[model samples]
Target: MRIESVHATPGVSGFYFDDQRAIKRGASQDGFAYEGDPVTEGFDAIRQAGEALLVEVELADGTVVRGDCAAVQYSGAGGRDPLFKAEEYAPVVEGPVADAVTGREAEEFLANAELLEELTVDGDRLHTAIRYGVSQALLAAAARARRTTMTDVVADELGTEPAAEPVPVFGQTGDDRYVNAEKMFVKGVPVLPHGLINAEEKIGSDGEALLEYVEWLVYRSRELGPEGYEPRLHVDVYGMIGELFGAPYDRDEVVDYFAALEDAAGDLPLQIEGPMDVGDREDQIDAMCDLRAGLADAGVDVDVVADEWCNTFEDVRAFVDAGAADVVQVKTPDLGSVHRSAQAVRYCEGTDTRAYLGGTCNETELSARACAHVALATDAAQVLAKPGMGFDEGFMIVENEMRRTVARRERDRSRAAEEVTAGD
Candidate 1:
């Protein structure tokens, strides 16, 4: 099948983009907005509405496939691309992007995605958002052209088996940690609340606040969670732990503190993301390695997750190669093309490091759904439920999409079995 035309539209993302640098500097939250000056170069304000560029590719049969281009909530931090402004990028999608894919064979996805990912405009690569969304549309187009699910398209191209069941979904609790966590326990999310403990105040000056929160989280899960409910506890500190402990991450005190956190969580598995930023990628990796080694030495059963400096595919490899993290987040948008996320996830197959097929709360339904296909196709350890901090909507979209894909694959398998019986 050949592509007919391409269209682009500026739209709103599910969440706001915050200047991570400003937030780290102790920007106070006033209502939903922050009261501080923007610290990132492209950010005009400390917080602004997130934007998405919607790419629609019309196939030859008049069927249009869609993808949403979005950036992370904390853009321009951790070596990510600058903030994504949909209005500024819509023209690029309509012009060179459209020109590149138009009239090309739509039945194959990998080559087209690679071509678009490497395409440069004005002596620079297309913004990561553009590459993300366009690649999603192309994947959808390939599935449509072949009369298959997007999951199957990805699996076939990448030489992997599609997941037989839904990937475990991880829920985020934003600032409403208590209430949203209740929702997750009730819903039986495999990974419980992603406590957004991103600031010094949130984690507490001495980290007492976080310890208390972990204890409460464990207690509440037993109190309200359904029968046989056991979920992993993941808290993203955004590097506040590093700030509090003042690294040389293998210090006796730091190891003791992690042991305390494990004790607070009782028996539930614990994973901490971005324990310390440390400003540079190499330094961040070294710090995480030191922390992991320390935890092992102290016999603390805690998983250190690498986030911050691990933005690109190369960065993920670096972390995985050194065994810096127990889990490495394959932040989808930061990786540019969707296939890269799949590649990153599969890369962890033989390593001690596991892939958390993660993205931001700022993505759209289209992007989230596309990632659902990727997660299942790659059989990732856990897939983040996202597009917003609100627990219900993101979970429903991702979980339902994976369920539906599984149902369809099952139906196909049964039909093929019956056909073989009839022929025999």
Candidate 2:
């Protein structure tokens, strides 16, 4: 269907609630930390606040599809900066850019990456934010038109199905101490301790605590027995490993860390995400491959997952081609459009490479729905639907849409089967 009109609703009300803590870091007001650090760093703070983009797309059929683009604040500090910043740019986008997209065929608008590029202001995060919001709205509209769930749309777009088993997911927890891998068996997912692996907070940098943590994780998994567990420990290096352990550390130190991690993990698998802030593309790939190789040498079969480094289609292609990573962490905003993101996933199809739907800490229902569509479309092995978990809104919208999509798909499949039976 053709996009009749694309506009932003007026009254950019704040979604902020008092209970939410800002992701920004500062000392007490009037203190040295506050003096040196501004309360907001524009887009940088926005990335942390987990902002939502509210968008409306009107189709020729008079269907007005409205949705939000949930932007994740990777920095993990919670605040309203991202939302506030997105609001600031709403006017410009709703005014001109929306006008530009109106009356265009939805498929055409989505296909024209070049035309969409003209609507953006280079390097402006708001531009990125607005573009993301619009893309999400259009995607929702398309899904509505097809009378299908976003996931089904995505599945049709990309040929795949849910893994025979749910793929395990891991994230960094608060303590540098990695959670015992056995916890994943109980939770039905992988647990990568987050707080423990912060680049700046190297409390356990010597590898002693990390090793112990891994051992506990592995031992617990073994205790649970094979049927109870999926053998894999997930880690988020978050670019710090590259910065902190760069050439200065002897290869032995690196080898030691992987060796210990492997020994602790036992027969289970290990997947490392990050080392994000590598110096260059080639360097990033090299580091990932090197780490993967190191772990393998230690008898730890591991898969390296990429985040920041795998930001675009080109990035995905590069990582896959170089054999630098085994899995691609797909984030909606990182690829800008659901279609483009789906294409990126398609690119990885049939290869040894796999894709996982990564979570944006701050996601709204609309954005989450769009992401689900992408996940379904791309047949991502796993997805994170933690809507409003990190932010105030929680998962209401995302959960609702996810349910709707699944139900719709089931009905469609059942109807097709019935049609075949009736014909016979």
Candidate 3:
């Protein structure tokens, strides 16, 4: 099937409740808040409306593939977006890639992995994002065309189905100390600390607040111990703790941080998100590697998860090749297409490293459904479904849809088996 059309739809919405004081309380204590303006940049306020991307691609057989692309702000110091802008690649979607895909075999479009990067000009993040949206739609269309579930397509491609066990879900709730962890515990999703330790004017440096925050987390974990739920807690440094400042912390300091987290979580498994910053690439990698080593030396059974530094398959390979991370956080859009993302997952198969299916806070139903397929397509250890805590209702809707899809697939399989047995 050749590519028939590539287009985007943009919408404005907010994820946070409209209570300003409550928002401030949460943001100040947790170091970040979901409330903010929709404009892509500038302004520090609770509840900013934001835009989402919807893409549609059609094939020669009149099959239509459609999905959403969510442009969300990364919730940390960098203030950099996750790079899902639609306008950045409007030309390619409306131009050459569109031309190359039109009337081509659907399989060929799916199989031609290099077309994404090749069609992209300047290798901008937007190109990758648009490609991701289109690819997801195509995968869904391909699944429908083959009368198969997206998971089956993935299983066929990967050569093995992912373990049937439900992957654990984790949420970054700013600071775990402020929220009722019991609510999340009841929902069966563990808590991950949003990487903001210092946002208050008098908080001095973030390091100081981070240390205190970790201590508080430990106390809360102990308090919840009697509830028969020893929930695991992880830290998302989000490119904060590293050896780049004038007075960089040594490996021991890094160990100390993990130790504090361990104590706080009652020795539960820890996952460190990232140490990636804009210009500190070398130092960040060194610090992360050293931090991993320190965790090993201290007998801390923790996993290092890469986010920013591992945006694509190449980055994922580089992280594993360098031994800088134990788990690679795979964001669907970051990898451009489910096909390419599946390849990255395959690359990690049979290795000690694990993959986590991460979420963008601004996702809609289309993107989330596609993401579920991608998750099922890979052997990821965990999946995060936080679409800004119910603001992006589509996120939750897609998750439910995925669950239903899985159930339907199983039912169909069972029916087929019964029919075969009756025939025999």
Candidate 4:
């Protein structure tokens, strides 16, 4: 089968893009939007409607495969690409991108994805969002051509088995942390709420607020969760802890605070993402290494996740090789192609670092579902339920996709077994 045509369209994402620098500098929230000018270059407002480029590739058989190109919620920070404007990118996709894939064989997903990664229009590689979406479309197109599931295509190419069951889905609660967390416990989400404690105030001047919040999370999980429902408590502090204690992350105060957090959680597993953003990649890794070592020495069981400055496959490898993080969040958009994300996840296979296939809430359902297939194929430790902060919508999209894919694959395997038995 061959690709008949390729096209691009502008669309809106599930969430808005916020200037991370502005937010970090205390941009006040005004209702759903931020109430200040953007501090990041390329951003017009502190918060703007998230944009996505919809890549649609039509096969010769009239089947259409889709993928959404989207950036992170906090674009233009942490060494990520600039804000994704669908309008500006639509022409590129329709012109050079379409030309590249238009008459190509549709069954070679890995090769096509690699070509797209190295594809350049004007002496510059395509944006991460473009590569991400185009790779997703190609993967789906390959599956359609082979009449197999996308999971199967990925597993075959990577020499890994597709997950027999759904990967654990982690949910994030925008600012409605308490109510949404209760909802998560009730629903038996394997990973509880990502308490978005980004600001200093949220962490408290002396770090009391975060401690209080962790205690509350433990209490509510026990009270509301189903029997045998001990979910991992993951929170994205966005470097507030680092801010509160000030650098040299292995300090006595930092160790004591993490110990306190662990005690508060009782027995629930706790992982903190982006504990500090020191504005440099090497420094960030060094700090995380110190913090992880300190926690281990103090007998604190909290896991430190690396997010900021860990934006690419190379960065993930650096962290894994150095033993800098307990969990390395493979932020999908930041890595450019979905296959790169898979490689990053696989890179952590025998290492102490666990790969959390995570992406921003500022994405589309198509992108989120595509990531679901990647997580299952790579056997990531946990996959994030995302596209929006609304606890239910994002969760439903990702969880359902994984469940349906697994079911279909299992049914196929059973039917093949039955056929073999009949042949015998």
Candidate 5:
């Protein structure tokens, strides 16, 4: 189907930084999570507003589609601001970005998506969010052309079908995470707790300290969590693992350390993400490879997840080729297009490595549900609940979206079967 017009509108979500790095770094005191403007102000609770751009596309065939692109909240080592990203890029989406897609076929717009990167409206490169918003809308429009759900469109493009069940949802754990962990575990949801290297205490400086923290995390989880729910104890180190050796990332120490943490985790499944922030794309890949090799050599069961610098289709493929990570965290916004994100999922599937459909708490309900559709279609290992970062809301939106997707796909399948029988 051909695109008729693309419209851009403002959207926002109430959210908090997954990690308030700037505020944490500036804090003169140790311990406690910091948030809010005048971030010098500290609060035990974290909640903020995240801005987004909603893209709606109308097709000549009379079908309408909508998608969302959310800003990054809690940036890592060096991350961009949500306001700056939204403000700087909105004009491009409504102007040149939309202009590029208008009057073109949906598939045609996607095939030439790269040209948008080169054809900047001003000096600024097309923002990632704009690319994501436009591509998502196109995907939805293509689904309309096929008279199927958005998940089906992604599945067709990936040469696959939606999964038999909803993708597993992984919940994020903040300062008040244990409280949520108990609730999530009771409900059988997996949790990725970041209290490991909180602003209150820096980990990785001491092997023993890291072990103790892991032990503490596990002990509390088991203590508070439901007995039958063997939820995954996924932890995100965010490069703190690199500091354990005081720099120059010692491969052997890292391996031994993860082995120890796995031991502490016992039967609970443990996956460590961004253990070491080595820097840049090349260095990150190399460092991850070294870590992965060391873990293999040590026969450690800990799965290493790559997030830093694994922001695009090419980056994910390179990491997969080099065997840099055991789990590839493909955040939707970073890849821009849902098509590219799906491609990353298929690439990881080709290898033994797993693909985790990840997005920040800075996303929106629209973005989360859209990504859930992609995850359902691509067979992603697990999909993260985001935009709100809270355990309950993110999980509910993503899980509900997948449930509806599966139901729609089943209905579509049954109709096709009945049509075939009628012809017979």
Candidate 6:
């Protein structure tokens, strides 16, 4: 079906736009410390209700489908900043942008959105925020047009079955986040631990500091939860490894650092993310490949994840093809289209690389839930639960969506089984 018209409006979100680069040095939430000393922590983040470009698409059949846009703060890891204002997204959804996209087939919506990004005068593309907002709107529209869920739409496009197990929920917290994680663990919720990108600056991205944080996470989960086991650890250095160990990366030093972390982590499986934000895509491939090789030489079993410069479909393939990372965090908004994100996941699946469908805490509830559908469809390594900078709200929202989605899938399967039995 063709889109008859597309309209946009101010939408509500359960998150905020935060510039961690500007956050002040102060501790909040569960005894975790924030040292913004390097960048001069001059500002504090306000957890205000965020805004989304809520798109309503009317199909030729006169049916309406709804979708919304949400983005991570920090300027899309610095690619495009639509300069999101409080009232609405900086890239207003209207005019020729809408006109160019209207009356297009739903399946063509993503490519058409890319065309809009390209056709913008002066070679400046629309902010990645707008791309995400618009493309997902079309995908949602496509799914509705087929009378199916977004997850089903993705499965059809990617030729994959929905994962039978509910997508594992990955949640991060420091300090008091333990209490929150403990509560969920007690209820048989398998909430995994994700340590922030070196938010503990006092230890200076040292392995010891991460060990302290992981210990707290493991101890709390084991002590409080029914399962007497440690949560798998994913530590996001956020490129602070460069701050600790200088660039022009020393292979031995890099291996040593991971070796230290491996010892500290003991038996817990360690997944390291953004150990270094190697500048160019070429450099990133080289550095990550060397690290991957170095870690193997040093007998470190760390899973290296690439996030920063790996922003697009091409970027993801480049990293995966080069065997540069164990997992690539498909930052949702950076893909410009959630469908492209699905393609990225499928691409990773087809290769040796693993996909971690992740966004930032800056995302809203709508985007997070939408990502839930994407994660379930692709069977990503794990989906980052977001919309909460702290441990509680975002975790609740994401886990609830997973549970609901699985329940729906189970009921569908049960009916299918019944039909077969009745026919027999």
* lDDT of every predicted structure (CA atoms): 0.93, 0.56, 0.58, 0.91, 0.72, 0.70
lDDT of 3 by residue, 1-424 (tens): 4556666555432242222233324343224445434332333444445455566777667777776655444422222334333455455566666665555555543564446545645555335556666677666666766677777766775676754544555555633335634445444454454433323332225455555666665566556545655555666665455432224456676576666656555556566676434344455556668778878989877677777656667777876777777887776656666677777766777777787777565556677666676666564676666566542243345456567666877888899999999999
Off by over 4 Å in 2: 9-48, 60-62, 75-84, 106-126, 157-187, 190-196, 200-203, 216-227, 243-250, 388-404
Tens digits of lDDT, candidate 4, 1-424: 9999989999999999889889988989888888978889999999889999999999999999999999999999989989999999999999998888889999999989988999998899999999999899999999999999888888888888767889999999888999999999899999968888988888898999989999999999889999999999999999888878865253678889888989989989999998888888999988889888888888899999999999999999999999999999999999998989999999999899999999999999999999999999988999999889988999999999999999998899899999999999
> In candidate 3, where is summed lDDT lowest over 10 consecutive residues?
13-22
Per-residue lDDT over 44-103 for candidate 2, one digit per residue giving the tens place of the 0 to 100 score: 322233445577777888888876654444421221123335556667667777767777
Ten-residue region with minimum lDDT total, candidate 4: 243-252
| lDDT by residue for model 1 (321-381), tens | 9999999999999999999999999999999999999999999999999999999999999
Backbone Cα, N, C clashes tallied per candidate: 0, 27, 15, 0, 2, 1
Best-to-worst order by lDDT is 1, 4, 5, 6, 3, 2
Query: Taking the tens digit of each residue's C-alpha lDDT, what string does model 5 give over 278-358?
Result: 658899889989888888887898888998788878888988999999899897777767778888898887697899998
| TM-score between candidate 5 and the true structure | 0.86
Q: For residues 109-128, could you state the per-residue lDDT of candidate 6 as single tens digits?
A: 44665565565633566666
Preferred candidate (TM-score higher): 3 or 4: 4
Best by lDDT: 1
Candidate 6 TM-score over all chains jointly: 0.84
Per-model TM values vs. the true structure: 0.99, 0.76, 0.78, 0.98, 0.86, 0.84
Candidate 6: regions farther than 4 A off? 11-13, 20-50, 59-63, 76-82, 86-92, 105-123, 174-191, 199-202, 205-207, 228-230, 420-424
Cα error, residue 198 of model 6, in Å, equals: 3.5
Better of 3 and 5 by lDDT: 5
Q: Ten-residue segment with the worst summed lDDT in candidate 1?
A: 246-255
Better of 4 and 5 by lDDT: 4
